[model samples]
Target: MRAVEDYANDDDAAPLDMLAALFEARGWPCSVRGHEVSGEVRGSWAKYQVKGIWRADDRVLQILCLPEVRVPDDKLGAAYELLGTINEQLWLGHFDIWSNGGVLLYRNATMLGDDGTLGLSQAQALVEIAVEECDRFYPAFQFVLWGGKSPADALEAAMVDPAGEA
Candidate 1:
């Protein structure tokens, strides 16, 4: 197994980079967008947005995954459910989801609430579900590091591309 530090240092490409490569391999044009969030109420957060344009019909697909912070333990289960829902309804389908503190909710380009929060186990479970479901529906989905790097690391990394520009 590769240590986190080792993988982080490897030139294997950041998560977004890897995603871009995956899309390209599948013959899709992809664009990555990165963002950072910090404030008194939420403290800080990061977001990574990946959008893919299909060459066949010029259709677009997007996936917005982020890391969150200070999530209360009590909310973990609900958060997991939310994550599963996003994977099944939005992410696995045509819509793109982007969020840091909360999982990005989308209604055809309209920003919705970011409602993902859970304990480690629940979070991992949610990730597992995403991995399986995404593979089943969208095999192109890949995970670099799930559960964010120690929560905070996950949040920061999710929102901001290690490559700098989305």
Candidate 2:
């Protein structure tokens, strides 16, 4: 098992490259964006968006990564509360949330119901849920490369098949 600290210190670009390569290996198309967002109340927020498809469905999975420091404790708490509300409001097909050091990964799941208009509170909530879930599934989260094959396999092995080993 790998420590969260080790994974956290690993290069962000390395994972992005590995993900892109995985997608390419599977013949899936992808787009990656690394950007910084600044706001009056939020100061400066760094975010990376890895958007693409793994299957024939029009659905797109977006992997969001943000610095832990950018997410305040109060905001994170609020996000968790909102996540509960969102989960109650809509049925989540599938999802996972994981964190390494100060970075968090929110991926899986189909787009939010209703044309993706999951208000700020709800969005934050979803992120919180994803983070928590990821922590529960440590090293496995890091194995997810592209086409989401690794994640799918991990979920099936760890969650779906209760009797199976992870």
Please provide, for model 2 over 1-166, each residue's C-alpha lDDT reduced to its tens digit, 9 standing for 90 to 100: 2222333345222333334443343344444445211111111232233332222143233444322322234344433343343334334423223333323434444353433222333333444444444343333333332223344454344343246567
State the C-alpha lDDT per candidate: 0.31, 0.35
Q: Which stretches of candidate 1 lie over 4 Å from their true place?
A: 1-11, 35-166
Error of 2 at 60 (Å): 6.0
Model 1, residue 157: C-alpha shift (Å): 39
Report the lDDT tens digits of candidate 1 across residue range 27-144: 4444544521111111122322223221212222223222222234444444444445344545433322333443332222111123211122322233233333333322111111
Clashing pairs in 2: 68-102, 83-125, 97-130, 97-131, 97-134, 98-134
Error of 1 at 78 (Å): 16
**Model 2 / residue 150 / CA error / Å:** 17
TM-score of each: 0.22, 0.26
The residue pairs found clashing in candidate 1 are 33-166, 34-166, 46-159, 47-159, 64-97, 76-118, 102-114, 148-154, 149-154
Q: Best candidate, TM-score-wise?
A: 2
Cα error of candidate 2 at position 19, Å:
21
